[model samples]
Target chain A: MTHVITDACVDEKDASCMEECPVDCIYEGGSRMYIHPGECIDCGLCAEVCPNGAAVALRLLDPAAAAVHGPANDAFFTRVLPGRQAPLGSPGGASRLGPLDVDPS
Target chain B: MTTHHPAPHHPAAHHAAAHHPRAHHPAVVDAEACSAALDRGETLPWTWYADPAITALEQERIFRRSWSYVGRTDQVAQPGQFFTCEVGGVPIVVTRDRSGGLNALVNVCRHRGAQVVREDCGTRKSLQCFYHAWTYGLDGSLRGVPRGDREADFDTSQLGLRRASVDTWGPFVFVHLDPEPAPLTEMLGELPELLAAGGIDLERMRFHHRVYYTIEANWKIAVENYLECYHCPVAHPGLADVLDVSPDAYELEVRPTFATHHGVVRDIPREAGYPVQGPVVEGQYHLVWPSLKVNVNPGQPNLSFGPVHPAGPERTTGYLDYFFGDDVDEAWIKAMLAFDDQVGAEDTDLVESVQRGASSGGVERGRLLLGSEHTISAFQRFVLGRLRED
Candidate 1:
């Protein structure tokens, strides 16, 4: 299982969890942050030190989210994630997937 | 919980009790070298104390590479929350933009390099350059230029405000001077374990008290003073009464890269468990290399870090912050704030006095008693070693 930042990090994307993760698994996802499950060491350091509860470990085989997590993680590492092309919240832009008003700052 | 242990007498008690690597590694500084420095009354590593050359080197080598604590996440809690802060003297603005993600940008504007946000904090959709009216979104993308079409070869996207490397830990926000810094995780090795043991659940905590002080002492002096409990017995009367500081009560431990001194004040009676969730230690002080100090007091946790704005060899500015758990009540917060004020005021006076005396040049150096002031001696050794390192 790798950590995934939920919508809570959307606008208030404080990156403390990014700094806290030892494996450098966290990456900027436009408005929110994403943890590459493939690279994650599952140290739980990100969740433990997040000032805002924006981080959650995605139990990869969770039949529901697995479809998105795999593609997302791959795109994040390859630096070709579609989310990067346009700003989040822009329609033809980055997907507005993360939390909206949850403040991570 | 017992706070007292019989004081032990040993040759290198200060060396052992302090966080001195040299105590464990005598070869680092030869015995003859120690004798020569001591004979000249200049032994205890003056490089860490009196060296402009080292300070400049630190700004480039150490501060630039390290994850510097810029501000707290709570400062920018709303959709457009924004604040200006400095990390290693680099001005930065941390904003929660319309999109809701926090962005750390050099406070300097892309146009004319004027600072965007002038005040401490507020809500703004985009930061407009006060001088030329060039505006940038919270995410640091250039959103509005005064005249987009006029400038030849003008690429607004290319002219976006430079974003600093930013990361958050608990309620604190950290920024690196490096454009591409080492991940915060690797930089903060074993600190999470230490913070967790001390009961700092970053998610539930809130930014409570922020007190800034301009001290006339080297930043290292404040740091060195903070790492030890030797002065608590003499200087901090209120703190001394509450903390568990008796003979053999303090233990300084280091985890390869980080150094921590655990001193529990077990005898003090609790009012209502601590204000936050954590073990009942009076204080857990952790010092991460370069410039970060976490003082996890029983009721509140305070972090202090800043460049030693060396106006000269004698003057400095000290910036301090205190964070508390969310579950704490307002009354408790107000009381804690009062307590913090007193402690901070007292500390400012004490440190400033030390700076004045040191500047007088009357005392060249002083010896450390083996048992009482081990932490100070150890920290001095650590400072000296880091200064010596390329």
Candidate 2:
């Protein structure tokens, strides 16, 4: 049910969506931003404000894309990032913590 | 909590969408058999769902003649404020003139038939056709022509935009294509009373949000899905929990021009969808004969209604406009919308599945469990009767 940031945001990390997100579930990757699946409230604000049309509802994604991205999004919060000691794992929100400087790739 | 009636409406006109020449196909639906099947508690032939000839007949007989919901008064509250919509595939524009009167006109330009008033909605003194600049007054009269002086045979006065009947119940506005159609009250039947019973203050309602959607199925299929909730327990589990969709608790009352279903809130409510507000005792849903729907959920003082019209023999399009009280809770509104969206998504899948099966010719007819789905029969009968009249 979380909105997923797709390959459209890979190089263009126009993070205007971060400013509009109420919970700041959007996180910065090296070249993109990933929406923390667990932290997202499914409010759809990120999908509305996304400049490059990167943020999309899980339902709107094609089945092939959804199949891959949904679990990958979960891994971003579960699997440890390159720099972080442990996985992001719902750090409450990303607004105050800023970018974690890593993604699940 | 306060009970209120619908707003008083004044003046009238018609609606718009471009018309295409209906290609006639021969007798497809056997009306007599369909009627007998309904009488015997059987369903109509699946051909009715996929036949272009029958769809054409419905477009002419039912949709064109019926008073269709087009927009709300809030959309055209000020002078020169206008919005365009279609009923029966004919483009229409509704505007408020300087005298504070509403004008409903065929949006098709009198010149080359290019549509005027192209935007979804805006404030403008005069509507002009984008192609030819054929200017029209807010009253839908032809006010200016690009080169009428050059065309010797032109009759500007006689060539003003065509009018259609327009009426309103509270904030809801309806338009008819018939030269002089029956009053919308007749079409509405006891629906206004149903709204009052639900305690929706129609006079105080304002437009909040709209979701325009298209279903890849016949318009009738989509409407039939709405007319009955027998499938709710299996198809719409979330909604089944919120509304007491039990056979005995759900009340379906069918009138000549309309049918309404009232569901008493079950005492076992705990979580999910929207909580019942203090004023709400039940969930009220209504269908005005053909395709217009009025749905008031439990948690909020709101009405979301719209018309479903055919995009093609196998396609349907419509919009649900959500209206709420002044300064209602924003969170409540979002919750209500999300709940509706969840049910709507489920319904889209179901109706589309039905359309797929019906289109395959695998089964001639879809038999119904009359006890739970009588409304579908009533609706199908209404459609067949209307088409038979022609």
Candidate 3:
């Protein structure tokens, strides 16, 4: 299991997680930094460094919110990773990206 | 390497002229010509958003060939610390070498098309292809091949990861796919001076906040929204309260190659229960053309919103950086973040609405209400004129 930064990090942007990561798995974004699940050794350095307390270390055994991880990762990757010139929450979650000037209904 | 000459009447030129009543438009105009357009007050064409053909052309001429901001110097903090990003939609990797120097390479591996850096970011002693264990050094040198000796004639040097032209300006790390790209400073024209006014001391500043929003609006719309502050009074009540609102307070400062608007609005009524504190800079908004913003709030740290996906037409990603002078304490920083989030929410609402409305019928070119929102008019003219020309 890996540690993930959630939307809570958006306003927090506390980079303590970045400094604590021994492997430096955390990467900064526009408003928040993220821990790369692939590279995160799951050693939990991020959880220690986070200032606003926005990082979450995922454990598969903890069946509470495991189901939401996939969607959350998708949201973080698509919205936080690549970043659109547009706004992520506009249509809530419009997968289709029309032509720039084309006003999608 | 295929060298293609700039043919007579480049395709971009024809497309630029088609948008306006002009007979001809050059594919690539110099900084001076662009400045002249700004001087004459001629509205630039809107092809930066509408023309996919022109966008494709820019991918090669602008993004591929120019030094573009890829990430922060802090991204690759140590050897093998690497991250994947896209330049002109081409995925590339930014890594730290054993020598601690940063390098950018195409994420695609030589043996297989698999991405060298599967994760968005991480620290590794070496980048190994997940598909076949083909490895690369932190400095982008080819390091290993699982069992390629059977090939009989395998030159490892030739298989080194593809290198890109990478440079650093301030905290921003930029990469250029073109082997011989123009220097980053030259491409920035007069942007540095504008950023300086916002107290952009790169060394003094450290990474504080990062949030990415994937908007449905064309990247241009987001840029346009950012370039102007006309919507501040109505759309951003929280922000408008801090800056003095008036035509004189928020006038467009346009040079040949740049344009910016700064103003101040009275603080929002505390009774209104908005997130604001201390003496805020009275409506000082600086717009560094193309895609950058340096926002100042007197007592608060200067906030720079550099939209990385400047030309991502269909979608846009923006980088928001908040820089605090040493005088700022942790509590102040937390309060500032609260204020920032509130203002960001307002912007998100307006921009998302505009993205949705642009698609509705009867918006070919929305009428501009001058005086109050002249920044938008200025931005629209610049964009339309730039697009209209080749």
Candidate 4:
């Protein structure tokens, strides 16, 4: 299962998880940071380093609750988000992208 | 572009009244007796460092009430430039308004308690909460609320970001969580004059860099380590080589609001990379109560300002803001920074070990060796006084 960034990170985008992620899969969104589902290696480094306990394993969450984050994270990269049509496949870093202005969870 | 020459050396000026070793430890919570003992050069109980309750008390009584360093005015020099910091776990954002006046606002959004300014620092026309885009003006007035027309009784005029007590002293900006705090200048006492006497130009100093350390020790342990240099001769041989670390040579003056440690530099060794030589340059370390520390080393026109903040009961997060004059060469600055890094590493090792011992339950109280460590005792007394104050 892929790692998901939960609601715990809503306004607290400390991005410590981004620093610990060896693959640099974590990306920044407008309101909250997002973790790319495809790029994550399930290393759990982001979860370990998250100060607010926002990063979690998808398998550990209740299926219904975990459902939103997985797609939301994918939507960030696929750019199926409300305002955009173009795909933003791995832009290397989060600082470059305009914030999606949506809740991260 | 002003330069400062070192003042004349003065020892025996600010020594503690007298040392009086007691056979038995007094009551730990007795503030009056503790003050007297500290006046006579004694330390606080070891348990004070490890107790979680004391940490909470300190946060309420000391950190909340005292003026805390937020950032430099230069950090937010232009209108709409802003930065966020936490004082005793309370998040605050300092911004420069259109009128060039500084404003310190509680960083939490009025909408849903979300942090309005998420990024550490940046230039923003308006602070918009990432949560719902509820926006605030540079002066902390509520500017926008998404879908506000739908609400029947929503009054946008009544809801603005709460302001914290904010002020500036020279280049530094400070905030107080207390609704009404003593003027920052009053709290500073004679620090302005003292710093001037030591040749520190508050207006001309420019930000160089910042380095943060997360230590596995209480915040006080790190602060106490800085308050005294008795550990230097043995624990810090590299530092001792550059600065005179002898107990007789080091001078400490404990004032009502702060403490200062003066160390004259030794004859520069041939191998040492210091750019200036002859007529020894002095090193001054000053601590403004609660959590501010300033260090000015010899042979360099630089100032290191740091604050030790408690992240948890046993964890501390500290960062040093290095400021240097334009004349100081980058190579010499880098070398000085490297030297500071080495000294910091040595200090953290010692402080962490002390933390382990203090938390191990093996010791209840530790002795304060009067001649060299009176400054530490003074610091403990300062903390205890604040903790017990009304």
Error of 1 at B354 (Å): 1.7
| Model 3 docking grade | incorrect
Compared with the true structure, what per-residue lDDT tens digits does model 3 show for residues B268-380? 44332233444444334555444555566545445554444643444456666555655667777776566666776666556555655553322433444554445655655
* TM-scores, all models, native as reference: 0.62, 0.72, 0.62, 0.71
Top lDDT: which candidate number? 2
* Model 4 interface RMSD over true interface Cα atoms: 15.9
Give the alpha carbon lDDT tens digit for every residue of B106-206 in model 1. Answer: 88887787887898888765566666656576787775553454459988778778888888876677888677877888867988877777777666666
Candidate 4 residue-wise lDDT, B1-390, digit = tens: 001111122222221211322222123357787677677665666556656677777888888888998788888999879999998788999998878878999999888999988889988666767776566778888755645645799997888899999998888889998778889988799988867777777776788877666777778887888888888888877677777778778888888888888888775453554554422278888888976888887775788887878866567777778898767779888787777777777777777678777666566567788777777877787788778876
lDDT of 4: 0.73
Model 3 / residue B111 / CA error / Å: 2.1
User: Residue by residue across B256-337, what tens digits does model 2's lDDT show?
Assistant: 8987788777678846677665465777888887998888887668778887889778778778888887767888888777
What is candidate 4's CA lDDT for residue B353?
Answer: 75
Model 1: reference contacts kept, as a fraction: 0.00
DockQ of every predicted complex: 0.01, 0.01, 0.02, 0.02
Alpha carbon lDDT at B380, candidate 1 = 55
Q: Which stretches in model 4 have alpha-carbon errors above 4 Å?
A: A1-105, B1-42, B147-153, B267-273, B276-280
**Each model's RMSD to truth, in Å?**
17.0, 20.5, 19.4, 13.7
- Lowest-lDDT window of 10 residues in candidate 1 chain A? A87-96
